[model samples]
Target: METMNVQEHWQNMALDQVPLALAGHEVPWVREARLAAFERFAARGFPTRRDEAWKYTDLSILAKRASFAPDNIPPDAPSEAALNAWMLSRQNVHLMVFVNGHYSPELSYPRNLGPGVQLESLAGMLDENAQLPPELFDAVHEHTVLDALNTAFTTDGAVLRLAPGTRLKTPVYLLYIASGYGVSIYPRNIILAGEGAEATVIEHYMGTLDAHNFTDAVTQLELASGVTIDHCKLVQEGSAAFHIAGVHARQKAGSRFVSHSFALGGKLVRNDITSSLDGPDCDCRMNGLYLLNGRQQADHHTCIDHQAPRGTSRECYRGVLDGASRGVFDGKVIVRPGAEKTDAHQSNRNLLLSRQAEVDTKPQLEIYADEVKCTHGATVGQLDEDSLFYMQSRGIDAETARSLLVYGFLNDVIERVPVSELRSRIVDMVLDRLPQGESIKELL
Candidate 1:
C-alpha cells in the first residue's frame, strides 16, 4: 500500500466534468452543494497512513486509481422474480433500491408504512421540496481524510424521517447494488427521527459477487428526545472491490440508539462509527462483526462521547480471520467534564484461524468527569484447541468439531441482533463462507 502515488493521482486528476454529472437538474441548490463538495475534495486530496485514524488501513491502493464519477444511470427494473427472490423478504420493511449510486424508483416499493413515516430518494426530495435543510450540505465532519473525501464526491442516496409519536412495526430497507467493473460510487444518507418516534432501519450494501469496484459512503443519523432507533448494516462486496463507510449518530435527552454492523466482503474494508450523547438519560449500543479470509483486510474504528450527565454507552465488536487475512479494531469512549454519572463500556475480541492471519485491536477510555464509570478491553487469539479435542473424542471428526466450535463461538455476538430473519441468515451466510465449511458439513 504505497502512499506517494495515490496522493499524486488525486493531485493530478481533473474535475472539469464534475458539473456535467449534475447538469440541468430540477434542483439547483443540491447541484450547487455537490459542486462545493467536489471543490473541497479536490483541495484536500487523499489521506495518507501518516494520519492517526487511518494508520492501520492503508489507502494507497485506492488513492492511485481514478474511481468513476457519478452519472445518471438508466433505470433497470428488477423483474418480479427478482423481487420474490430477495433474501430479506421476511422482514416486510419499506424497501428502496439504488443501482450504482443512482436511486431506481422502479425497483423500490413503499410498503405498509406507518402514518408518520416519510421515505424518498434524495434527488426526488430536493426536487419536490425547495426548503430542505441547508446544514445537510455543510461539511459536518472533516477530522479524518476519508470523511472529507466522502463528503466531496457523494452523489445519490435516500433520506428517512419519522414524525413525533410515530412507532413503526416494520423495518425500512435501503439497499444499494453495485454492478460493473472499474466502477466507483458514493451514497450519502441522512436520517431524522423526531421526539418519541420509534423505527428500525437496515442499510444493505450488496454488489455483483465478483465485480471490481469501490464504494465510499457516509450516513448521518439524528435521534431527537425520547426517540429510539435500531440501525443495522450488512456489507457484501466482491473480492476485487474496496469498501469504506462511516456512521455518525447524535442523540438527545432520554433517547436510545442501537446499531449493528456486519462486514463480510471486499478485498479491503473499513467502517468508522461515532456517537454522541448530548443530553441526560441518553443511551447507545454499538455492536459489530467482521469475517475475513484470504489476504483481505477489515477495520473498525469507533468513538462514543458522553457529553451530558447520566448517559450510558455500550459497545462490543468481534472479528474472525482465516487464511492470510488481517483484522483491525480501534475503539474509544470519552466522558466530558460535566458528564456526571456517565457509564460507558467497550470491548474488542478477535479469533485467528491460520498461522499467517493477524489482528490488531486497541480500546481506549478517556474520562474527564469524577463520577463516571468507563472500561475498555481488547483481545486477539485463536480457537480453543481443548474444546475441539474434547468434541473429537466424542465421536466427532476433528474438522467437523472445529467448525462447530467456531460457529458456536461467533454466535454470542450474532445472537444479539434483534431481527430474527437477519440473524438466521447471517449465521448461515457466515458459516457457508468459512474455509472448508461446506466440505466439513458434508463429511459429517
Candidate 2:
C-alpha cells in the first residue's frame, strides 16, 4: 500500500467528484470552465507554508481530513427566530437566504426590488439561460487552488445587477447558513453596479455551533463609471468550522467601492480581498476587523491595484487575539507603470491580550510610477498598560478596565463603518464577547 500526498488526494477528489457535482447544470460553457478550473487546481495544488503568500498560515489539517462533497440532501431550514437573530432584525432590506449552497425561497425576501434592479440566484440564472458571460469566472487570478475548487464546485449564490442611474435605498442581504454536519458548500456571487448606480450589499455566513463544516465562497463585483457601492461581509460560522472566502472588485472611472469585513468565528478562517482600479479617478476603501479566542486562527490578505492614473485607495485592518489563537494580516498595494498621481495608504494593527497569542502582519507597497504617493505600515502590540492602569486607578476593576481599553482600541475602526445600524450591531457583538463584557457595556 502506498500513501498519497495531500495534493494527490485533492486532485483525485476533484477528478472523481466534479462531474457528479455538475449533474443539474447542462450548460456546455459552465462544464468547460469547471473542467478548466479543476485542471488549474491540479496543476497549482494547495499552497504550503513555504509559499510566500501562505507563510503565516497552514492548511495541512484541512487537506488531511477526509474529502468533503456538496451535501445533496438539504437539511432542515433554520427557524424564523434563528434567521431574525442572525440578521440582527434588519428591516426593509432585500434578503436572499441559502442553506447548504441551495437557495431557499421561503426564507428569502425578493419583493419590492423596484425598476432596473435584478436580484436572483446564480443557479437560477443558469437554469434559465446557459449562455451567461464567461467573464464571470475571470475575476480572480488563476493561480489559487481554493478559488479553482470553488469555481469547479460552486452551485448557487446571490446575483445582483443594477441598471444605469438606478439607486436602491434598501440594502441587499445575502445570508448563507450551514446546517448539516461535515458538509462542504461552495458559494459564488456576482454584483454589477451600472453607471451612476448606487447600492449597498451585505453578506453573512453562519453555522450551528459545534457542527463541522467547510465553506468556500467567491464573490466578484464590477462597478461601472460613476457607480457607488457599499459592501459588507460578516463571517460567524461554527467554532469547529473551516472557512475560506475571496472577494474581487473592479472599479471604473469615478466609481467608489467601500468594503467592511468582520471575522469573528470559525476554528480556522482565511479571507482574501482584492480591488482593481481600472479607470482613472476611482476611489476604494477597505476596512476589516477580526476577533479570535480559544484555539481559533484567522488570516486576512488584501491587495489594491492602481492600474490607472489618479486612483486613490485607503485600507485599515485591526485584530484582537486572545487565548492561544493566532492572526495574520498581509496587505499589498501596487501602483502600476503609467499610473501617475496615485494615492494609496495601508495600515494594519493588532492587539494581543494573552502572552501565548500570536500575530504576523505585513504591509507592503510597490510603486512603478514616478509621481505616486504611497505609504504602508503595520503594528503588533499588547494592550496599553498606561491606559489600563489609569482606568484601574479610577476604581474600575482590572478586567473591566482591560475590556474598556480593547473597546476603545477598536472603536476607531468601528466608527468608520458607513451603516449606522451595522456599526451598532458590531459594537454589541464585540462587547458581548469581550472578557468582563457586561461591566464594560455599562460604561459604554
Candidate 3:
C-alpha cells in the first residue's frame, strides 16, 4: 500500500486554528509549550506503519483529509434528558461535562466536592486568566506525535486536584460528548493527588450514533506517596468515529493505581497507556476489554515501568473480534536496573469469531534486574469446536452456545470491575456485540 504525505495538510490545519487557540487566556508558559509542541508535530507529522510503536495501525486515511476544528464553545448544551440517557449507571457523584472538546457549565454539577478537593474545568481556569502550574504544560513535550497534536490544539478538559489526606465519598466523573461531523477535538485532563489522598475518577467519551468526528485526548495523573486512585475510562463513540487517547501516570512510594478501560464502538480507535512506578512498594494494575465487529479496528498499547525496588505490576487485557474487524495488543513491562524485588506479569488474550476477523498480540518484558520476577505472554484463538459440539449435543442451539462461550471468556475481566452497577452495564454492552447474546441473558 502506498502512503501520502500529510505533514503540510496537518500543519495548515494547525495554522488555521492558531488564532482561536491563542484567543483563550493562555499563560506565557502554556503559550510557549503550545508553540514548541506545534513545531514538533509539524516536523514529525503523523506516525505511519513504519514506526515500531504504530506498526499495527495506520493513519493515512485520517491524514489524507483534514478535519475541522470545532468551536471553542458548543452551540447548544445537551438537554437534561440527553444527559440522563447517556450518563453512567452510578449517578451519585461529582460530574463535569464537555461538549465537542469545550466545557459546558450548563450541564455540569460539581458542587460540594468536599474539603481539600478542587474539581473545575481546565478551560475555565485559563479563561479566567489564572496562572497554572508548569507541569500542566509538561505533557506538551510528550514523545508521541498524537500527544503533541493534542497539546497543540487542546481547547478544554477537566482538572481535579486532591489535597493531602482527602478522601471523597463519591467518584469524580468527566464526560466528553462528540456530535459534530467532520470536526476534530482535543481534550487534555490533569489529576494531582497528594499524599494519603483517595478517590475514584471516570472519564467517559460518548458520540452520537451517526457522528463522523475525530477526537484526540490525553490524561496525566501524578500520585504522591500513600495515595490511592481508582481510574476508569469508558469509550462508546460512534461507529464512524475516529478516537485516539493516551493515559500516562506516575506513582510514588507506597502508592496504588488501578485503571480499567472499555472500548465498545469506533471505526478506528487506539489507546496508549503508561504507568511508571517511580518508588518502592508501589502497586499498579491495568485491565482492559475491547469488542469489535463489522470493519472496525481497535488497538491497545501499554507500558509499565518498575523504576524502584519492591514494585509490583499486573496487566490483563482481552479482545473479541467479529465479522471483518481487527484487534491489536502490544504490552511492554520494563524492570530497570537496581529495581530489585520487582514482580511483574502481563497477558493478552484474543478471540476471533469469524474467519475474516484478525488479531495481532505481542507481550514484551525487558528486565535489567537480576532479582526480578517477570513474565509476559499472549494467545489468539477461536471458539472451541469440541465444546460447541458438546453443547449442541446437550440440546443447546449453535448461536446461543457460541454466545455463552464468549461471555464466559470475558467474565473474569468483568469481575475485576469494582463498581457493581458499572460492571453490569459493561456486561450488557458486551452481550450486545455477541451473536444471539441476548438469548442467553436470562440463563446467566
Candidate 4:
C-alpha cells in the first residue's frame, strides 16, 4: 500500500484556534516545547492502516482534515446543577478539571487530603521537577508509533504522586473535560508511587461539548519497591471524539501494579498498555472492559514483558459491541530468556449484539525462558442464543432478555473493579444505556 504525505496537508489545513503561544504573548519554554513537538509530528507524520500495529484502525480521516486548536473557554464555570446532571459527578472525588488542554483551577475542587499524597497538575510538576523522565521521548523504540506521536504533541495533563508509606483512603479523580469546538487536544500524564506507598487513582475523560476532537493521551507509571498502585481509567468522551491512549508501567522488586481500563466513548478509540516487570517478585494485573455502540470503534493492545525472575502477570479483557460498532483486542506476553519461574495468564472475550457489530481479537505469547508458564486465548461471539431464548420463554421479551444476558456477561468483570462507588456508577451508566425498554425483566 502506498502512503500519502500529510505534512503539507496539515500545514495548509486552516485551523480556527492556535496554541496559547501562537494565540497571544507566549512563554519561552512553552513556545520551545510546542515548536519542537510540531517538528517531530511533521517528521514522523500520521500512521496509516498499513502500519502493522494500526492495521485495523486508519488515521487517514484525521490526517486529511484540519482541526481547530485547543481553544475556547466556557462562558461560565459549570453550574452545580450542570455538574449534578453529569454521569460521573465530581461532588465526592478530589476532582481536577481541564478545558481543552489547559487546567481550569476554578472549576477544580480543593486538593485537601492527608500527608504523602500529592494531587497537582502536570505543568506544575514540570516547573518544579526540571528533570523530565527519559521515557517521555525515547520509550517507544521497542515498538509502535502511537507513543511517539503522543509524546511529540502532548500538552497538559495530571500528575499524581504518592509518598512513601502513605495510604490514600479516597480515590483521586483526574477529570479531563474537552471543549474542542471541533478541534484536537493532546493530554500527557505522569504518575509515581514511592516505596511502600499505596493509592487508588481514577483517570476519567469526559467531554462537555460536541467537537470533532482528537486526543492523544499518554500515562507513565513508576512504582518503587513494595508499593501498591491501583489504576482505574474510564474513557467516556463524546460521540465525535477520537481518543488514542497509551499506558506504560514500570515496576520494581516486590511492587504490585493493578490496572483496569473502561472504554465507553469516542468515535475511534485505541488503548495501548504495556507493563514491564523489571524486578523479581513483582506482580501486575491488567483488566479492561469496552462497551461500544453506533459507529464507534475501540481497540486495546497490551504487552506484558517479564524481564526478571519470579514475577507474575495476569490479564483479562472483555468487550461489548452493539449497532455498527467494532472492537479489537491484541494482547501479547513475553518472557525474556533469563526470566525464570514467570507466570502469566491472559484472555480476551467479546460480545456482539447487532449483525453489523464486529470484533477481532488476538492473544499472543512469546517465551524464551525455559522455566516460565504462560497462557493466552481470545473469543468473539454474541449473546448466547439459548440463554436469551430460555429467558424469553419465561415471559421476557427479546430486548429485555438480551439486555439481561448482556448485563450478566459484563457483571463479572464489573464486580472485580476495586472501587465500590466507581464500579456502581459505571454499572448504572451501562445499564441506563442498554437497548432494552422499561421492562422489569431487563432490570431484574
lDDT of each: 0.78, 0.84, 0.83, 0.76
| Better model by lDDT: candidate 1 vs candidate 4 | 1
TM-score of each: 0.92, 0.95, 0.94, 0.89
Q: Tens digit of lDDT per residue, candidate 2, span 52-104?
A: 98887887676665765666677799999888887744465888999999899
Off by over 4 Å in 4: 1-38, 72-76, 87-91, 127-144, 437-444
User: What's the ranking of the predictions by TM-score, best on top?
Assistant: 2, 3, 1, 4
Which regions of candidate 2 deviate over 4 angstroms?
Answer: 1-20, 139-143
* Residue-wise C-alpha lDDT for candidate 3, range 372-396, written one tens digit per residue: 8888888899989999999999999
Which candidate leads in lDDT? 2
- TM match of model 1 to true structure: 0.92
Lowest summed lDDT window (length 10), candidate 2 = 1-10
- Candidate 1 per-residue lDDT over residues 393-436, each given as its tens digit: 89888877777777776777888787787787788778887655
| Model 1 misplaced stretches (Cα beyond 4 Å) | 1-12, 16-20, 23-29, 75-86, 435-444
Residue 132 lDDT, candidate 2, scale 0-100: 52
Alpha-carbon RMSD, candidate 4: 3.3
Query: What TM-score should be assigned to candidate 3?
Result: 0.94
Model 1 weakest 10-residue run by lDDT: 16-25
Better of 2 and 4 by lDDT: 2
